[model samples]
Target: MSKVKGHKSVIFDLRLSTFDACLLMQEKPKVSVTRTRRDSAAKEFSFTADSIPAGGLKDVRAKAWDAFTKFSMPITTDEAWRRTDLRLLPASDFKIPKEGAFEDLPVVPESLLKPLTGEQHGGQITLLPGGSRVDLDPDLVSKGVIFTDIRTAEREHTELLNKLIGTIVKPEDGKFAALASALAGNGVLLYVPKNVQVETPLHSVLWGPGTDLAHFSHLIVYVEDGASVTYVHEAASPNETGHAMHAGIVEIHVGKDANLRFVELQSWGRHVWNFSHERARVERGGNLDWIFGAVGSRLTKNFSDLDLAGEGSVGRMSGFYFTDGTQHLDHDTQQNHLAPHTTSDLLFKGALKGKSRSVWQGMIYVAPGAQKTDGYQANRNLILDEQARADSIPGLEILADDVRCTHGATVGKFEKEPLFYLKSLGIAQAEAERLVVEGFFDPIMQRIPFEGVRERFQQAIQDKLSVDK
Candidate 1:
């Protein structure tokens, strides 16, 4: 694949033999081809409202399935999708496993089981293919905190789930979002009641199914007014030769005067295609701190957004990604200021090696009458090889005359001055490069709240660098 300079356009070659050309000339060519028509694998996969089992969410699934049937997957013509191409994706090869098909759970990686803070988690949930395990501190549960699987919540906390589910991220958001809503059967829910403060962090791990299968997971975090909490989520899978897919969603609600810190780590197998829609809404006087780490997957497209919907609300986002081999990772982010006196800040940093490519598109939007709004966004990328490529686009749209908004983006290679300085100190060339890479990601690493997590990311970076050497 190749990209044009100063534009986010990819050049694809279409090869047709003489017979193919003759057949095309015999019929009127269509202007566009939908995803189902282009992908033979997708034609084999079919779904309807009746396909969903009877449950509290059956209606929700039905509504989403209807929407999914009508909507088509994104194409390069769409403004938001112009930078990425989906023609090479094997959409039909991975089928969603039937309920109760995965009775034997896969072993959880030791790295995932290790504590991120070197202390006990207030609650923990591990989601397998068709089963889940949950653990919560009795003290927190007694205080009205609920941390469990979605199935249990549907049976015990029906009113709460019905009220909050599909509220933050609706099916209308995108095509994959509609599919996820209609098919997702495994998920986690974390609810903190009003005025409750949880000092320990909650953790969740989602392990993908084996080859030729797909896993759709959802996460909901609700912090009521005057409540505070921290949560961490991780998604990963073992390496496999066959294709797989992960379509997921995350919705967060921070109520008035509430505080929440959320961290997400994505490390899918090399044969996986990942797609997700994640969003958070901060109400009046609420605060949200979010961090995202991306390190694996054959191809990924993710959308992350934060809405400052009430006066005095604050939102901050820190993101970091590393790509190698032929991996492609694209992240589209937005920070919207919808109320006066609201503030939002975002920074995304990435490093690319081998033939890998990374794309980052960020925007800061200020709605009308959003006076005293402050918004800022920046993206920086480091290129470690001549064959690697990185694209950064930053934008701003301000309807309010009294708001302040700024955006910046940069893509560059390692500065010779730093390498020379390190070499002058007798540091080996490989070691110097590794140090530079770590320094490039230090700003985002500092924003992580836990020491163990930081060290884990550091180790991951080292491993990537070593492989390159």
Candidate 2:
């Protein structure tokens, strides 16, 4: 492989073979961490078989524990984490929520409990601290659809769960991933059998604990060949003063010719530190549409990746985020074209207010022999306040000479001309600013399949604009 490196970008010419290109793709730069600090932080919480819920997945848990003990927390010195700092996280003060801690479910706020789409979901699941509840349409279930909590799946769908648990996002992906896999009990699973097309969408909500505790959740979505489904997931927490942490994982697999639409909304409380790894793989002729919305958390660092693993596969990612107060949100995304004739597109737009900050780093990679690959990525940021900050980094790595790959990044303040135009029309300054911001996010907002969710996100943006005004 011949390398040509530029600012935040790399281009490689794979003249050897496709296998060689695949091997090189597996190589990642190692980031060193402070061992003493890592060990000190790890000692704060203990994970044992007794602490974890009794069920299957013992081997998976054991492998995850090994990885968790072997890996250390990443530091800011790492390139991917350079823009986000974890020094403010009080790791030693956090405790793992004991089993039965959520025997009586906490009063979830109306905003979180409310349905984003007015229509009823084909299936719905809520994952609390220690327990979960699920409701699915009997017709879908009769059609071989599987939608249930992890515990019940463990008891009933053990073989399938065991086969697909860590295939996409392995425990060794990162330190936090390992930790989540090791203690994963509060989770939901959605499985659609071959050739089944569910007309209605499925929904899942993961509510974080409000206390000074840590929680881990996992999500698996499997769509078999010729199947189609849409899934919406929300991760939220109630406002609290104490510090808390959440480490989660999401794995998605779309079989040959299958179609999957996945939506993820994150609204962690101001006192929570959130870390997660989410990835999706599309097989031959498969299609995937992914939407990400971020508007909460004291600090959030997440990785979202799409792997077009088969020819004729297509993937699209649309993301929008709004940050206010002292919040910090970071997203790292990757579009990997692993097979020929694959297409991928990504666009992420964010707005920052108050003293908040947002970071977006995107990469589009085309493997060798992946000819006819078309990939595009762009990140646009709008800063609403002088103190607010946004960082946009877009990169590309292509090994195929015939592929078309392009990336762009822009970070700018709200344009004065637009605000002035609105103000001259008798709109108030605040209202004018809101209109400008709304227009800036229109492209991404339009991509949202659910109308209610789009309106909810608009209201959230307005709330952020109203803060400290």
Top lDDT hit: 2
Instruction: Give per-residue CA lDDT, model 2, range 158-221, as digits (tens).
Output: 9999998999999889988988898888898889999999988898888885677888899999
Predicted candidate 2, C-alpha RMSD: 6.8
Model 2 TM-score, all chains together: 0.90
Give candidate 1's TM-score.
Answer: 0.90
lDDT (tens digit, per residue) of candidate 1 on 163-260: 98899999999988988888888899899999999998999999885887878888999999999999989999987888888989999999999999
TM-score of each: 0.90, 0.90
Stretches of candidate 1 exceeding 4 Å from the true structure: 1-53, 99-105
CA lDDT, every prediction?
0.84, 0.84
Clashing pairs in 1: 41-92
Clash totals for all candidate models: 1, 0
- C-alpha positional error of residue 364 in candidate 2 after TM-score superposition, expressed in Å: 0.7
